[model samples]
Every structure is written in structure tokens, then in C-alpha cells.
Target: MHVARHKWRSSKTAQRGVEELNAQVARHEGRVQIVNPEGLHPLATRPTLREYISQLWARRFFITADARAKALRTTRDYRLWQLWLVLNPLFDVALYGFLFGMLLKTSRGIENFIGFLFIGIIFMSMMTGLMNSGISLMQSSRSMIRAFQFPRASIPFSTTLRSMIDNVLPAIVALLAAFLFQWGTWPSWTLILVVPLFILIHIFGCGLMLITARLTAQIPEAKTILGLVSRGLFFLSGVMFSIDRFAEHSAVHQVMSANPCYIFLTAVRDASIYRTAPSLATWGELVAWSVGAFVLGFIFFWRAEDKYVRLV
Candidate 1:
């Protein structure tokens, strides 16, 4: 009985020692002290920018998993499930190919008009999809945003990721349709250039997501008009025809040609359908737009992080 009592005392002593060590480590770890409590932030308060980035890095897996889950459920409501991803592009190709290629005859001066139209329509849809989804992101993730305390940027980032996943089949189909309809030859090295073009375009899309997500949180009604904005961008993006269609209006032609959306689609078409190297200018614009937009958008969105939580 005496030995048992001694062992119990030893165990208690060891437990106290461990707790004391933990306290010391906590102190060294910058544990905040509650002196007045008024200055204390909630446990999940917004971290500093550097810390916020690190948090995002640490949560990369969670972001990808969230994206995967969202991607899977994206088409659940549709009767055809994932086939919509493939069919949607085909439908767009057919409708536009008929309207612009047949009626408007915008396909007149272009080589391999069918392939060009397919690549342009499918690629531009990815961009418009990102903008539309980002504009509605806060509303769609309202419940999760309120219940959790993660970096709000993760929503847009995950959305960008989800877009990448969902666009895979469509992107592949675009290239295949190009080959099947017009560019009938063995794949060339220039075709591989589409890969980088794809990545940069999606990076640009992520930036669009960040910008629109913040805008949406600020002006909830902005969501309604954002779709129209995307459609406007789509039409101006040279999706179904070349910018030469605006040749009579030099001013409109210049603006449309200079548009980053036009540049991106033209780059993919040049690389994939035309099998020609995209100009250094095309690559430069893509890099600048993708990198610049992402950096600027991150700062803009981070500035409004606190506002997202309160958005209804």
C-alpha cells in the first residue's frame, strides 16, 4: 500500500513537470496573455499577410480536397452527369459554328475555321466560368464561410482549382476537335505549347476569381450583373471569329485586339489549331496578366478579408 502511494506521487510529479514544460513552451511560442481582454482578438482572428500566406500554404491539401469534392458534385444535378462537360463544348461549337460560321460568315478569312472556333469557344468558356463562379462564391459558400475561420482567399483559390479540374476534359476535347475537324496531322511540338498556355490562362482566371469575390462581398447585387459582364467579355474575346471582323471600326478593333482575353484565346489557337508559335508578345501579355492580376487581386482580397465573414 505504501509503495502504491509512492508510485502515485511520482506519477503526479511527472505530470506536473510535463505541464510546466508545456507552459514554458507556450510562453516561448508567443501565447497571448489576457491582461485586459479588450485588446484580445478571437482565436481565429485574421493573421498578418505573411502568416496568412503560410496558412494558405499549410492548407493546400484542404484546398485541393475541397476543389475535388466540389468538382465531383458540380454536375450531380444534371441527368447526364459528367457528359455535360464534354457536350457543353460541342453544343457551343455547333451553335456558334452555325451562327458565326454559317450566317455571319466570320469564318471567311481564317484557316481551319472549325478548329479555330472550337478552341476559342471552349477556352473562353473557362475564363467566363471562373468569373461567374467567383462573383457568386460568397453566396454559394455562405454557410461554410460563417461556420469556419479559414483564410477567405481559400474560397477563390479552391474555386480556381475546381475550375482547372472540371476543364480538363473540355480542354482535351477542344484539342481533339481541332484535330478531327481541321488540323489533320500528327501532333507537333507547337501543340505542347498549349499546356503552358492553359496553365497561365487558369492562373489569370484565379486572379479574376479573387477580384470578383471581393467585389461580390462588397456589393451583393453586383452578382446579378456580373454574368452579363462575363458574356460581354466573351463576345469581345474573339471566341467565334477573328478581330479582323472589327476592321471597319479601327478603334474597336484595336481595343479588342489588345484585350487580354483576346490575346489568351489567340495564343491557344495559334499554338493548337494553327500549329504556329505564339508571338513573344502573346506570351508576355499572358504572363503579365496572370502574375500581375494574381498579385494585385490577392492584396485587394486580403484587404477585404474581414468583410467577407459579414457578407450575407
Candidate 2:
């Protein structure tokens, strides 16, 4: 009887141990309850839109500094250094002027054709630079991404900022060329509008860069495709010719006129060349494009922020 009792006790102890082990395993399988001041969050996932923007804002200083650094780095090693900034645009203007003005005679009807062409080339350069930089933005920042924890949007934003800075010398040269070529008149109060218009363009470029950066990150091959597409856009953007030439084709005219490059070039020409404030319609369009693209691109990029690291 005593032996039987001992066996029964052993069995009960073993059963109790098994039950304890199962309880522990079940508790571990339940949802993780992380406790911290920053709140519980997954490391390998994207933040909400609101949170992402907030994080980006927090790093604004970094963006500006990085942009300036990049701008300096790019020109530092060049043979002509900063001179290329002005000379490059001048060369492009001369080339396009020959093609469209001399060969095609597209500039025959336009008043101050030189000024119009200058503004178009300089402004379009900004757009092209933004798109091109965006394609390599993620790849360029792979090292930074691995080392730091910051918004990926900052890379594209910094790129746009660098482009804007690089254009300062070119813009001055273009303006001077326009005036010398009789494309622009003396500065007036209307010229002040260039400041605001440029700000809008910068915003628009930032948004576009964001979208392209995300796209290239997701699909590596998109870089080559985007380069070709951007070249085609240069022709369609009315950089070398007036959109009015297409006035008879309502569909084509509307498409080209609605292009952000065309809108920005027109605004610059109106302010500097025509000595007039951009019309309310133009202002509305610029604002709409800038705000819409920025919001949409930010959200789109932030949606895949976590994935960027994996892509590299």
C-alpha cells in the first residue's frame, strides 16, 4: 500500500510540472507587451504618415547641412570647379538656341526669344537634376542608412536642396545673359516674385525626388528607364519652344501647358522678362502642384521606408 502511494505521488508531481511548462509556453506565445517611454513599436516597419513627417521635421538641420556638403563635394573635384555651374547652362542655352532658333526657327515669333530660352533651360535643369539625383539617392545613401536612423525622405530632400544651391550661380548668369541678349528688361518690383516662384519649384522638385527615390529603390532597373523618360520630358516640357505653337491641338497644348516645368518656366518669364506678376491662375497651379506632390510623395515614400534598408 505504501509503495502504491509513493507511485501516485510521483505521478502527480510529474503532471504538475508538465502543466507549469505548458502555461509558460502559452504566455510566451501571446502578444508581446513592450513597455517604454517611446511606446511599443516594431523596428522593421514604417511609421504612420503623421509620425513620419514629424520625424522628418526633426531632422531639418541635418538635411540642410548634408545638402551643402554634397554640393561642395560634387564641385570640389571638377576641373573647372564652380565655373561649370555657370558655363554648363550657358553651353546648353547656346546648343538649344542653335537647334531650335537657327535650324527649326521656332524662336522667330517670340519676343525676347533669348530670355525665354534662358529661363526655360535654367528652370528645366533644376527639374532634370532633381529627377536624376533621385534615381541614385537611395544607392548613394546606403552607407548612411546602415549607420544612422533617420527619415529616408531626407536623402531626396537634401538632393533637391543641393540642386537649388548649385543653380544659384547659373541663375545669375542666365539672368545676366537674358538682359545682355535683350531678353530681359531692367529689374522691377515684379522681379521680387521670382523668390516665391523659386520656393514653389523647390517644393515641387522635392516631391518629385521623393517619388523617384522610392521607385528606384523598389525597382533597381527603374533608374535607366527614368533617364530615358526624363529626356523625353525635356522635349515635351517646351524648354526650347513655345507651347503656344501647339495651341491648335487642344489636347497636346493642355498636356504641355499643365506640365510643372512649363508652368514654372512661364512664371519665371512673366516675372523677369515680361515684368509682370504671375496671374492668379498661375499661382494657384504652382501651389496645387507643389502641395499635392509633396504630400503624396511623402506618404508614398514613408509607406516603404522600412523596405529601403532591405533593398540595399
On residues 57-153, what C-alpha lDDT tens digit does candidate 2 reach at each position?
Answer: 9999999998888774566678888777777788999999999999999997798899889988888888777777788788888998888888888
Model 1 per-residue lDDT tens digits across residues 97-174: 999999999988988898888889889988888877788678788899889888888889988988898888899999
What TM-score, to 2 decimals, does candidate 1 have?
0.84
* Cα-based lDDT at residue 282, candidate 2: 87
Q: Summing lDDT over every window of 10 consecutive residues in candidate 2, give the lowest-scoring window.
A: 179-188
Q: How many backbone overlaps does candidate 2 show?
A: 0
217, model 2: CA deviation in Å? 0.6
Weakest 10 consecutive residues, lDDT, candidate 1?
180-189
Off by over 4 Å in 1: 1-39, 42-45
* Clash pairs detected, candidate 1: none
- The TM-score, computed over Cα atoms with residue i paired to residue i, of candidate 2 is 0.83
